[model samples]
Target: MSAGPFKVCMLGDFGVGKTSLVSRFVRSTFSDKYMTTVGVKVDSKEVARPGRDPTKLVLWDIAGRNAIDSVSANYLRGASALLIVADGTREASLAAALNLLMQARGLLPNAFAVLAINKFDLLDRWEIAPPTLTQLRRAMTVFETSAAAGSGVEEAFAAIVAGLDP
Candidate 1:
């Protein structure tokens, strides 16, 4: 059976490891250096879930930039879901990611959005407090992940797929 052709967008502030997360998930590779994504890179993968036909996900790894507000409308076209990633090691960017979410909501009001706290491996060095995480939950589905270690990467994608189907 044919399943979606769903379009998923990755959004966040510059240097939040949005590209790294996508690279890890799709390509199974990690890099210590920060390489900015230009425009957008699209990758497709067919995922099989237990009770459903394989779904074709069109993953759009959008570029992270300093001026997220200016490019918000341009990058979110035809998106079925969004993964809003934040660098957990930098607590300040979490708010920036949330603001991006608000902007994204304005653009794609009905699209499914997931709040991913990336770089969990750096938690020991992070300043993010427990209450900040609680505050984040008020907006969307939140997950802690490490692109470097591959923690919660697949599950985050799977959850997004399930949310989209539901």
Candidate 2:
């Protein structure tokens, strides 16, 4: 059966691997090189479930580190969910990601948010210590993910989908 389309937005700091996470989830692929996302990139995929209609998720990967002016607010309009991604190696980037979330919270207060700590594969050498994980969890649902290895990527997306309003 068909399901209604849902919009999901990805917000984070530069080089936080938001694009890589989306690519890994939607295309099942990953790349190490960093590429800046311009304006916004939209991708649609159907999420299958047992005994229920498949949900259509329209993923929006917005540009990182861009000005959070009126234009950025426009991009967040009508988003059903938000994936606030941050580099596990950089605590500052996580703070920046939180700021972005705060900016859109007014517009999407009910929007489900999943805090994805990207690049879990680099956990051994991460600058951000374990304490940060505890702090992040207090804010939202936190997932330690490695897009490069495809670990917890699909599960994270599924968790966000489960949180979305039906």
* Per-model lDDT: 0.83, 0.85
User: TM-score of every model?
Assistant: 0.92, 0.92
lDDT (Cα, tens digit) per residue for candidate 2, span 1-166: 1255889999998899999999999999888988898899999899976567788899999898623677778988988889988888887887887888887788888888988888999988677777878987886888988999989888888898778734
Q: Which ten residues in a row have the lowest lDDT in candidate 2?
A: 64-73
Q: What lDDT tens digits, residue by residue, belong to model 1 across residues 1-166?
A: 2268899998888788888887888889999997777888888877777788778888888887533555657778888899998888888778888888888888899889998898899989877887888986886688998999999898899988888887
Question: Which residue ranges in model 1 land beyond 4 Å of their true spot?
Answer: 66-71
What is candidate 1's local distance difference test score? 0.83
Which parts of model 2 have CA positions greater than 4 angstroms off? none
Worst 10 residues of 1 by lDDT: 65-74
Q: In candidate 1, how many Å is residue 87 off? A: 0.3
